[model samples]
Target: MKNYDVIIIGTGAANIVADAAIADHKSVAIIERGKFGGTCLNRGCIPTKILVTAANRIREIREAAHLGIHVESVHADWAAVSRRMWHKVNENDSIRTYYEQFKNVTVYAGTASFVDKKTVRITDANNHTEEITGTAIIIATGGRTHVPSVAGLQESGYITSETFFGAAYPPEPYKSLIIIGGGPIGCEFAHVFNAFGTHVTLVQHNIRLLPKEDESVSAYMLQQFEDYRIQVHLNQDTLSVRTENGEKILTCSDRTNGKK
Candidate 1:
């Protein structure tokens, strides 16, 4: 059994607590099941937004004709976009190296679960297990997408934000995309993929996209999505998704009147 003054599970925002403890001469163990940085850094925010920025530029150029400025043939290379984004995020070794530089800190890569209060077990990739006990253990395991229980959806190979951005080889720029859930992530992806020349259809169960935002703002954003040539299907629940003849098709029901 390994012993430490502090055991911080998940190298995310919560793991920053170890910095102060380590500064006070306390030995700390930073446990992470995945990469050194958490979701925002590795998969979610940082890298995805960078791609979004590039997409925005493409949209601007394509729309430049309306501004009386003729910028011809502005194209977005999506495979290049996905490739470069991952290349940049995966290339960073600063976080891991910085943590390793301190003799008082230890980094463990494995799945961690509590055995008892103040005791935890970590199972690595090879299934090798080890127990670590600490005076204080902090769990900062971040969130993952929760897929809903829908018939044929899972087997249809539907892609979520995580799998799309986290894959080793992302899809080679599909010509069309049907994105469900028109909240922030879905809207952002709608903009990105639409800007990348993909025909995007955004479906939302709510009456409008961005349900959590102000009503006026949501309406304006929906207008913007329409202006971007994105097909918007509001107040519709996806009944099922199935691949038919080498193409995936999504069936939906109008939630307002309970009709398909």
Candidate 2:
């Protein structure tokens, strides 16, 4: 059993804590189940923003007429965009290599389970396991996507924010999309895909999109979506999802009127 001064679970925000501990001459152990940079670097903010940047350029080109700049054509090469995004975001190995240079830091690439208040067992990709103890344990594991309990959703197949930039990412923009949420993630995807010429249908259980935001902001977003021809269905509760004859179908209920 190896021991350290600090055991940090997750490579996300916990990285900051690990650095601090190492700087203080304390031995540090980091357990990461996935890539080194965590969600933001691997599947979240950085990658998503790369796509968003392309989407923004497309929007600017389309709206350039308002500035009296008549552009003949605007083409979004999804292959090129994806290549660039992956090239920029695929730094996991580099991150791990950097951490390995530190003599006092032990990087465990695996899932960790608590054995006690100050001990954890880590199981790596090959099913190898090791027990490590620490004077203190820091849990900086990030949040995950909350899949709603809709019937046949799993069987129908779906991708959450985590998988959107992962192996499940489509080679190109989908022809059409049925987004089942009205929160930030759903709205952002709707905007990006719509800008890329995908017909988007957004279903929200709440009466308005961005329910957590101020009502005025939600109204403004809805108006913008309308202007962009993104179909917005508010007060909708997704009841089921199924693949029918090679087509993905979603059944939702009108929350206000109880209509299907």
Candidate 3:
């Protein structure tokens, strides 16, 4: 059994707590199921922003006509963008290396489950198990994409934010994309792909994009989406997704009138 002054379940916000514990002359143990940097660093905000930056640049160049600067052609090199994103976000090994350098810090690459109030069992990829107890346990495990239960969604296959930036990331921009949900992630992806020359259709269960935000903001975003030539479906409830004749198709019903 290994013991520590502090045990952190994840490497996301827990990193800050670990540093604090280390500064206080405490031994720290970090157990991570996936990548060391957790969601925002590994698969979420940071990587998504990298792609968004490229998309924004392409949109800017294409829309430069308003400033009397006519750019004849705007091209997005998806391979280069993807390479840069992967390069910047591939810091898992480095994070582990840095943590390992600290004699008082131990990094475990695995999932952790509680054995008792202060003790936890860690199971690694190879099914190896270890027991560790800590005076202080910090559970900073982050969030994941919530995939709704819809017919044929799983069998037909789809990518969430996790897989979208991971090994399963497509080599080239998709020719077309159907994005469900109208919150930040879906809308951002829609803009990015549409700017990169992918036909984008965004379906929102709510009547407006960014439904939680102010109505004016939603209205403005909807207008901007229209200006970008991105298809927007409001108040839509996705029924199912299927692939037929080598084409992916999504079936949705109008939420307001319940018409398919």
What lDDT does the true structure give each of the candidates?
A: 0.83, 0.90, 0.91
Clashing pairs in 2: none
* Residue 181 alpha-carbon offset, candidate 1, angstroms: 0.8
What lDDT is reached at residue 58 by model 3? 92
| Residue-level lDDT tens digits of model 2 in 1-260 | 89899999988777889889989999999888888888888888888889899999999998999999999999999899999989977787898888889999998889999888878999999999999999999998888998999999989899887887777899989999999889988998999899888999999989999999999999999999999999999999899998988888998999878899
> Model 1: per-residue lDDT, tens digit, 61-178?
8888888989858867777787778777774367877888899998888999889998999999999999989998888888877676667987888777666666633566668888
Pairs with backbone N, CA or C atoms under 3 Å apart (clashes), candidate 3: none
**Candidate 2: which stretches are off by over 4 Å?**
none
Worst 10-residue lDDT window for candidate 2 reads 159-168
Which one is best on lDDT? 3
For model 1 the local lDDT of residue 205 reads: 87
Give the TM-score of each candidate: 0.94, 0.97, 0.98
TM-score, predicted candidate 2 vs. hidden true structure: 0.97
Let me know the TM-score candidate 3 reaches against the reference structure: 0.98
